[model samples]
Target: MEPDRDSFTSLEPGGDNAIAVTLGILGDEWNLWILRHAVEGAKRYGDWMREGAISNSVLSARLGALTDKGLFDRVQYAHRPDRYEYVLTRRGADIWTVLLTMWAWEQTWAPPATPPLPRMRHIGCGEFFSPATTCGECGAGVEAHDVVAELGPSGAWPRSVPASITRRRSAGAKQPSQVIPHTMELIGDRWSAAILGALFLGARRFGEFSERTSAPPTMVADRLARFVRLGAIDTEPNPDRPDWVSYRLTPKGVAFFPVVVFMITWGQRWFRAPEGPALIFTHRGTGHEFRPRLACDRCGEELTASAVSIEPVAD
Candidate 1:
């Protein structure tokens, strides 16, 4: 169904929209890589430089921005040369779940290639495991279908779309060795991320996706096609109209729920609208507001940065 044109709104920067604010921060490829490296113990300026192969000026700018966003604490480590390192703050460390979920998605969906992402071993269980998103209150596993979403007090789409500063950079830049290319393709682009978010929000038709994302129809068509090729989304016959089809998440797409949930949780904590979070999710099974926690599939204990180690993918 085509949504009413007047019903949708665009988000402007610094608005009372948590998703917009969060997207503006983490939507960049470099930023995601930087945060990923930070989680992996890349603290020194040269550390991320070597790991990401990012140029100095861009690295400096990104570091500064991250510091400003309260994600990193810039501490001087040397006196004579004024050397400093970027350390993740509590809020920044919370991004572990986001990166872990992305890793899990890539492990399940990314085409195998050289130098794949390292395997994560849960130290508590002494076994490698993928992250499972679970409810904090009820301890039940969560998936996209298990929740009900409603617009919060400040849930209305904003007045203008937030600018995507990373698209051109990501398009022109070379792929980094320690990067998640598939995840980047899905989320490195703001429009794609918005479309994914829209799908999770119950947008099923072409027009609905376009309206919900505020993206051009042509762009929406292109992304939907790309997702279909990626096996993340599939098309089904629309019973309401035989000529029309609805787009729905395949298991692969549904598996991406953790990534979305983590991002939303991070955004809610770091950014806020006047009314509250832009979107509110409630677990239908628990009948309570859903708070996502990433736990190890092996031990069923909550995963933490200090409790896990990364190792080469076993042959």
Candidate 2:
């Protein structure tokens, strides 16, 4: 019998252990907060609470949830008190690249003066770092608009397309969650994109996000929640205001910096004003402008959206 369409299928069926870690972790606000704290070295409960303004109940619940998911380990740090601290497991640390990318993105697009708390650096290079997205082949910069969608060689497609794209093109309906459709769904919405941009710029407060985007407070709240669920943003308690809350990017959220940086760089180059962008990024070490280009790391070839192919890895 044919399997149900909604049932999950592995990219590699029983070949390698490719767990659906993305879908599993991205489900709620607290989980995201736990991750953010873990990234910030908030292993102990007291340290986490001190680092952000999360409520005790919420923090407890999120810690438990993360521990349950195997992203964090609750190890006993105190003997008499029988206290535990949360630490990132290997699976958790693997997502750090994503966080660094997100931080780099915010530094570029959002307001430049007020950066997010706790900046990132490349430990290996010992320099304050901004992540760059070069082409996997060419190492040159590419923009989102420069990429166009086409049918894959395998003839696979996402299950659905946004209404706006469909209206723009007189093509037949396609499956949703296919590559192009999924891409649009991920980044097409202005509010969603704006929220991401703001987060990159260090606007974690509701009012700050709303002010930055000129979006409704309610909309910002909803989007923040959604981002939290997507493991893109973490919701935490406000440090100064006990009843209030704040948000920050998780490691997964930070990893998205490359995507944001690429898109914004593309926008600036293709859509900037005659006077140039309201903001620009510079390489801290070289004192040169950082205009990212996407090229393949191995082949040094520019990868257009159409030029790339996604093959399911063997399990």
Candidate 3:
């Protein structure tokens, strides 16, 4: 059955939330890698081919989808057998911080061995630094414990991201050449992503998770087990009910909050709704709406793609 186009177009989480819609656009490994390469200066068709071992057909499909999704603007750079280069649109360039945050998370937890992930030099501070997450309003550092999240105007409605819309790796597809980070594993799966979001929202019991995410019991059980295996969450016997269990985020899981914050920031900024945002975060310290900003860990200045340089990582 075809997924509902109208439902998918909206930015709400209830069958039509922005986060799920954005995830449908970016949740695939190849899609993420393509965005990474784009940030690293890949534009022309040949540029991406040389940057990664992606096949022509796959790359073509990805580029087309990204372009259709408003991340890239394809422009003709030549004629005759007309040739074009994909340029990042404003919406596309904004993915820099999201990718940077993911990179930082990988470095700390899933360190790759092939070649070290590139060093980031913040030209603003003239120092090599990791990206830091901070509240844009007050400039104070932000963490899961430092903020409280509440359902926004649209958030109160129960919505389930259509499972069919999310892109998934085929069983026979080539495994991602880059080291798959925990962030990828968690976010790439719709159910897993929704369940983790539920945990952050204080859904400790199984029923709450299932209800909030609108995931089937089997799917929820499978992802919850996977989270435990990844050490992102722990399962504990419920104190009041011996028959049930509670899921709690481990330190590693809580550490993933920055990625979630960035994802929410990017998604909400790009995807709008007539009602309101799906989630509103209030910084515990400032008592102000939490808008996430990526800053240089060394000098505390905001990090921008132009203001920072990434040393290319070897494939």
Among all windows of 10 consecutive residues in model 2, the one with the lowest summed lDDT is 154-163
Residue 204, candidate 2: C-alpha displacement in angstroms: 1.5
- The residue-by-residue lDDT of candidate 2 on 13-45, one tens digit each, is 222111112323332334544565566566887
TM-score for each candidate, following the candidate numbering: 0.89, 0.42, 0.90
Please report, as a residue range, the 10-residue window in candidate 3 with the lowest summed lDDT.
1-10
**Predicted candidate 3 versus true structure: per-residue lDDT over 173-203, tens digit per residue:** 6644554557766877778778878888898
* Candidate 3: residue 35 Cα off by (Å): 0.8
Whole-structure CA lDDT of model 1: 0.78
Candidate 3 global Cα RMSD: 3.9
Off by over 4 Å in 1: 1-16, 159-161, 168-172
TM-score, predicted candidate 1 vs. hidden true structure: 0.89
- Candidates arranged by lDDT, highest first: 1, 3, 2
Candidates sorted by TM-score, best first:
3, 1, 2
